[model samples]
Target: MRRLTAPLPRCALVLGLLLTPVGCAEPEKDKVTIMVPWSGTEFKAFYAVVKDFERDHDIDIEPQVTRALTQQLDAAVAADAEPDLAVLPSVGAIAKYRQAGALSKLDVDTHAYVQPLRGLGMNGKDVYAVPVKADIKSLVWYDARLTARPPGSWSTLRDRSDHWCLGLESGPTSGWPGADWIADILLADEGVGPYTAWASGEGRWDKGPVKAAWTEWGDLVAGARKGAATFNFRAATEKMAKAGCSLSHGALSAMAFDSAQVKTDGYTYVPSSRGALQVSADFVGKFTGNRSADEFIKYLASPRAQRTWVNEPGFALSADNRVTAYDNATQGRIAAMLRSSRYTLCFSAADAMDPDVSAAFYRAVLNYTDGKDLTPLLVALTRVQRELGYTHPGSPPPPGPLCSPPNHP
Candidate 1:
């Protein structure tokens, strides 16, 4: 016969129950990693959106910020250690990665975006990327206290070099500011046909409009090149008052002033009368084919997210037509220009060129700013274009129109 086991005391039973493991722990949240080049306030603005996404979906977002985005990304891809997504400012890089089979197709709806913006990052019918932020580069910022009137023409603007503040240094992208000036000058002086042709690589760089545009920019900023090449672009605007620089040419986002301080700082801007305003966008693309990553990209392209992002302190513009309102009058005016059918929009030429070609272009600008001759530089660029098969006679232009016509969007 077996003896009956003694029952545990109530307190002991309760203690045993408490000590036993249970399934009460919270489940792990899904995670998505994104590589981005943003820092400071720009990153903060972007992170605001990331937090919104995280809260809505119960996912964790890990952002890897770096100034050398291109180099780091290339290495990551080679090692098969790429992030789930990346923010690419260079459309050329998007195309490059897509062609190399490194990018996963995007399923985000882009109907709200305007023409070329909708068309960018498309490899045939497959969408590889979607623009998350946009900026208008065709703007001239000035301290109203110092200037009675903004320059009405390029000639007048060029003649006022003493009042012009410029800084070409920006780490790996040092000469891009100069490139913007040249592209705007080309589009304004030569017209869209030539600008598009040259940008697409069909036109010769050493001849015609491209050379003229380069020369024009050289004349405008060469005098200021002494310290500008090494000077940081962000600091250019801040030192304007003390440096006697009344005029600064760049996107509002590039200014050192915050969005709230724009109107109050006595700084104002005018749209470059340049034929078509130069515009750029930071696009998001998938790399690891993660479902959560796809969701994040979709959220970023959504109208709600776009609206939220533009209202932040970063001064970003949205390509989404649904994003109409802005927190301040300055932003509202810029947004209206972006949506208005009256103004034509052209993608930034350097941002759209082949990565190698773009790198060369940047170097050429910096060298030219240092008093180097422009002819050899143009010849070298033309040779590079030819070798890349962009300058072959009867060669087809890049798939889509480089410059969008007014009202086309």
Candidate 2:
């Protein structure tokens, strides 16, 4: 944290007390509160960014708890007591608020960020938000010794199927793992069109591409290939690491390699031809009618702010592709993957989707992987997607040509 060096004069301090009540003194700078779903190390990094901005501008940013953004923001909107800004962690929320007219227009140039990231904050001619953080998904973490050459194809991936340490359990969110597998398969097989259609409540699960994702997962788990379906994501990844499992099919963070406190050679992006990747994004939205909020928005898109956030260990990669001075080789590889044209850039289809719709998909994946017929699940999913009337306009389309599935690696 940076400290201001100059001392205040006695007369100035006396005047400050006269103008403002003791112990409740007015702020020296305009206060701008921002709510976002960030805690722990991520919050520290976020505060660092805000501190840097505060030093440059006449504003103080207050970070708040982000437990109920939609409900709370709605209440605030009704009361007309909304905060200056908010950092929604998903594309769907950003789109929903913008469509509801809760966001104010801003001139923040999003092109300073990555190409795909720019789309998350769009509402046609107006830019409703600016992406502040992003996590590249669609990844594969492996045992460095085992993956020295790293298998380049699904065939090579499944060849070591028996050695996989698999699990689909996540307590209440248990089905997310299964859903990720299906979503990744959809991304690899259907490309961006059908994959994104499903995400935005515009696609049907009974379709060929959706069905294909479900069936392939079934084949992988057929006859105990997926032995552990009750362990949550963290447990599964840690188990895989300890058991020397061949590969964990998810993002860099999904493996919990950095958080696990275990030593190993870092992770790498699986080649595009062989697998798919997703990017979890944090988008900044404005509400208060304050110019300071607008200035903060522009600062967020600048390299100075992003540079601070990227320095936090295991923090998500910056949405700004132009900045890449990570502190470690693993972070560098993940950032490089985001910058590369060879890898597919996709969002969590479920994350960008309706909560109920995403939940249904997770449950369906779990049931289907646990040996239930996929027909009923797919039909149910299709019905739910149709019922989720709200639309999410910015869910990205596939980055390149979709490769047909069975992409194990």
Candidate 3:
């Protein structure tokens, strides 16, 4: 509950407003709403910051929490009950909203933000979303109790399957870890350009590297871990949390799980040699008739807000590098990665297609546990890709220093 030193006093905000003559009228209320797309521990941690926001700005935040996050947003948009600020996971939706003129452009400078998250929004120039937090999918967290050395390459992860432990239990998004596996392998095997091309619907998933990635993942799942397929991601992760497991590959968001026994030691995080880093952008959801919502978004980008949020609990990482400099080891590491990443890659899980189509990608990988036929899976995915117009739409590759193809050690 540490409070960041308030910038200018509340009186300053009032003083700057020369609406009245002397000490006459009262200051206007800065009431707004925000939607947080997280539950349980993560939600609680983020709420701490929102409460602080309420306190500092003398604002009342109508905080809404829900499980069906994207649906909630869609409904909000459809019903015209848009909130002032929305902290959502859908970059494509943000793109759509920005295109449809539902969001206002951010007025702040965004030089220090990571490239991938920054790329999430914008219809050719009108930047609509500011990246609040991001998760890096290139990390492999290993229990130091099992092995002292961190894994260096994809070959090591495959060759030494005896120590490779994976948790795929994130419910509806459980298969995403599997997707990361495929994406990482391809990036390692090919380069960032190919992965980006495929994700944007330009490249074909049935192609060699893409197919090879699935094969590699299948071989790992079918190998020594006999019950790997049956390991319910939720249960498996719980098992990892309690008894301490070997190694698992996941986003930086999962670093909160590392404790004394399940501590992160030889954990190595690198681009898949292919240079793709999975990322999601933070967008302002249109909530009800709230005029001051844009001000809150500005607050989110404020130095005070950013600094305060990094210290807040839960599994969030600041997109602002300055705020994380004084954080704990894990937080600092994640912040550094976001700041220095060569390419911040984003996947088309939520925005590009219907839930059924998205679920198919997960089911295909989950059900094909015993190295089952993947040709049909790829073919099916190809059809879905075509139906959704997912073929890479040819946006020029990421530019400048951020365009380097990241290589994993």
Candidate 4:
């Protein structure tokens, strides 16, 4: 029987069908399907592991790839046709799913895994999803050819203009990069307490640290050294790759080390190099009635599987070290930065707000590109922040009487 290691190739399927027997005993009935959210090369890399899963367990596995993974899962569950496992990118929903009885808690000993991943499972308790791929976001990528060493803090980043470039123009998520800017400033200047409070909705946007975060970002944007408003992430990244740009901020996954235009040695990586690292938690949901579904989940958390699937070469970092993983020198530096993060928070894109609220923030930012008033933008954010219910994770509910909600003109 052919071994499965990664995503199945179409050619392999044809060969499998052709080789199956005349009077053969029916194949062992271990069959499963796994769903994931990302597309393109990412899907390809993850599918590699799916191939491996099937080979080791004598399982016949199918992969369902979709861009709207959350929506697809919801539709499937509603139709009572949910797959055995689904990969998600939200811990808030994971908590809510457990509360809603929609997901089973990952019941197993995780003693051998990394300690930081304990809460990473379900609802501060049950282990539901085993982390697969992780990108450390606190890293600052700089052109070593130009600056040699990048600045450490927000102050240094803003004041020292030896060289800096940021692609704030990621479409759909253009404002998201701006959000990262705000998040990092808050994390660096105020610490986790204030950032957590804000994330949990108990903290006010106009409060000192929150305001300071916005002010800092505003000051940076309006500073002496300016970034191209129209440049998307790729442009800034390309510049950094060619050593034309001195510094850029992004996740470890953003820059590929082998890009032809990039002079690999020109890049330097660091944790908190840009700001406090935030994570986009990806998880898998269980809905299969198969007795062996538990086995699959356990394997996902196993050291052997982790090494082959999650931590394998060319793949991104996994949250826990179920097994040793390797990366090239540049990627290793990025991983080191992620592994050493002190203040890891969820990305704002993962914040529990109506997508429209986020859209509003984005629109306001795009308007700011045209030199719109900062006060109006702040006022709009305060409203959006209030109405959408800003919040923090792992914090006690706010104390004292509630203040009157702010209004936007």
Candidate 5:
């Protein structure tokens, strides 16, 4: 018989075991292990939700938090020992796993989720994951004291030198930030058609628009060169706030936002202007079809669970429309932008692309920062892009039927 190794304390995290109680008289409730990418405070918040759910139900949840979710999941699937569930990286990944028979189709009411949220992790008839968290990307953080207001154009900001904080620290997944910069600029300059084509691998990286975006980004970095190239994203935002750098771009947590400027998207846009919001998450997928996990998924989609999520610090609102309020004005504004039909809700190109192809693109961008010419990098990445092609032939199936009962949302 398997032995229980850990107590049900709030902080005790056990790694391996058949956690389901055995040798019981009546019947042991289903014990499920859920792996997610959220660690530290995010894990704490997640545990609180699990703890509350456990208190009211007959189930045991072993929450495993790891940043290397993809690697761990891969290893598990290889060894024929995948976890009961996980918040996988993307719906594209979900499709691959679903095809491999590594996951079970979810049986939950998805009517509340919007079309974009439903499209990912879903095939023609089956749903795989439940959206847990999302974010607004391509944000530019400026010091209120350094700049009177957000710049109308990159040109306006470039007019002032030595006022930007930039970082391109090399890591395993380095250069993603650069890709984001180029993609955001491309979306705004060329519109969604080209961005979607390029993201899905139908377009070429060496094309004029792609190269132009890279050049524009390079020009931005060149004008603000001051130990900026090696800043490393870690603590850079805090340092920017303290050093009073006028302009910065990237995701900054609550601590960094304290010293940085905050404003609504009142900045005017030109004719070619564009913005993209990616609503991604450590999406939960029930792989083993454990009843306990299914119960948890239901609770997760409920308004009560969503309300708790919105109140947590450093988190955006759930994709569910019932969760309309935020703990503060910042989340509220970001949610408004995401839900607005006027603005395009573009998923992350890197997240949606094939892993190997995406890695190549990321590496090429990283190399570009070290004085390497962008021409060859684009050429090589474009070659890989052409070979892969999009995840689906055309747009995914319409989720209008699920999102029907419009009055409910």
Candidate 6:
């Protein structure tokens, strides 16, 4: 016979139900998915901010990393499987998605950012994207030991190509470094008027300043390493000391040098002459109408978050003026330049072109680097630009200025 058990009291039974194991477990967090192209140190810096956000809110951030962000994002949008947020690397992509209705309006405050940075993702009154990270492409970093002073002009630097550490390879975006060189040279030599016209798809590529800019860049890199076309940009940057090259022209973030090295006497950078700086930003845009995603994006653009990100190991810069301090004097100075209205900050030309046109421009850069003629290449690029008119026929131009001047709207 089984032993008899006593019946539970009603009070005890109620207490047991109230203290159920399921209810004792932690509640599930709202997950916000963000797709980005950063990895290694860049990803680490970004993740640190994400972790901080996770700690302060009852939300979980799921980051999907990809090197080919453009292609992957396109595929995701086509499949109706877009992430809650995505970091768009180019203004062109941002406009494309915005026009396609894939991106949602952002409600973050952008008053702290300067002109084009503030307007990069706007379509009339709607805010579609916010710049999360900025790169000052108009900087030329050099080893002070080898070069007494940075070149006073682009022409002076052009003839010293042998002392330059140039690399064109960056996977799918291999030719972008070359592109930046050309854009910066054009902007510096010709000023903002022609630069803006060419970048806005209103100017011809096969003639005048655009053609001259390409020719100049080709001459500068004519003596670059034989394997530069295939050399990884980061590796090329890191190998500068070993290669006996004293000068490297690009953003500080692309230098791939240690923070300690940057702080040393040997490493230094000078702003590109003439006060025309080529800059680019990784813009974050919302894809889904999730509240968590909105909060995440707002937080990412916040001054506090921007500060945290810039101080991290990767040495990212912020477009937000409120993010005033930096990890070091070098970074602080650069950040100040970005916020200053005294200098005209121009968006990357290829980045402002249509996506198809931008890719074609990249290919042209590579071919030119490989000793191919530039006239036919420019003509071919112009044809691509003409075929994919920047906007629909009779439609107003895409929102935002391609180049920002002092006190610009």
> Which candidate achieves the best lDDT against the true structure?
6
lDDT of 5 by residue, 222-296 (tens): 744445446565455556657755566644333245511443422211212334444344467877857878889
User: Which stretches of model 4 miss by more than 4 angstroms?
Assistant: 1-25, 28-30, 78-81, 112-116, 162-164, 168-174, 221-235, 259-265, 273-276, 309-315, 333-409
Query: Model 1 over residues 9-91: C-alpha lDDT tens digits?
Result: 66689877887655566789989999999987788889999988888898899999999999899999999999999988877
- Which window of 10 residues has the lowest lDDT sum in candidate 1? 1-10
Better of 2 and 4 by TM-score: 2
Q: For candidate 3, lDDT tens digit of each residue in 1-409?
A: 2244465566577776764564576777777767777766666666766777777776777777866666776788788777777775655556556545667666655555555555454445556677775556666655444454544567666776344555554645556567667776766666666666665555566767778878887766554344555565545544444544655666533544643222233343434443445544444544344556766777776667766666655446666556655345655665566655454444433333333445567677666664557898788887776665433243122211222222211
Sequence-dependent TM-score of model 1: 0.91
* Candidate 1 lDDT score at position 369: 86
| Consecutive 10-residue window with the lowest summed lDDT within model 6 | 1-10
What's the CA RMSD for each of the models? 3.3, 8.7, 10.8, 11.1, 9.3, 2.9
RMSD of 1: 3.3
Candidate number with the higher lDDT (5 or 6)? 6
* Local accuracy of candidate 4 as per-residue lDDT tens digits, 305-377: 6556544434365555434455345554555544443444344332333344555666666666557776777
If scored against the real structure, what TM-score would every candidate get? 0.91, 0.77, 0.77, 0.74, 0.80, 0.93
Where model 6 places Cα greater than 4 Å from the true spot, the runs are: 1-19, 252-254, 391-396
Model 5 — which ten-residue stretch has the worst lDDT?
397-406
Name the weakest run of 10 consecutive residues (lDDT summed) in model 4: 400-409
Screening candidate 2 with a backbone cut-off below 3 angstroms (N, C-alpha, C), the clashing residue pairs are: 137-278, 138-277, 138-278, 169-232, 170-174, 192-398
Among the numbered candidates, top TM-score falls to 6
Cα lDDT, model 4, residue 366 = 62
Q: What ranges in model 2 sit over 4 Å off? A: 1-28, 55-58, 67-81, 146-150, 162-174, 200-202, 221-231, 252-255, 259-269, 272-277, 366-373, 389-409
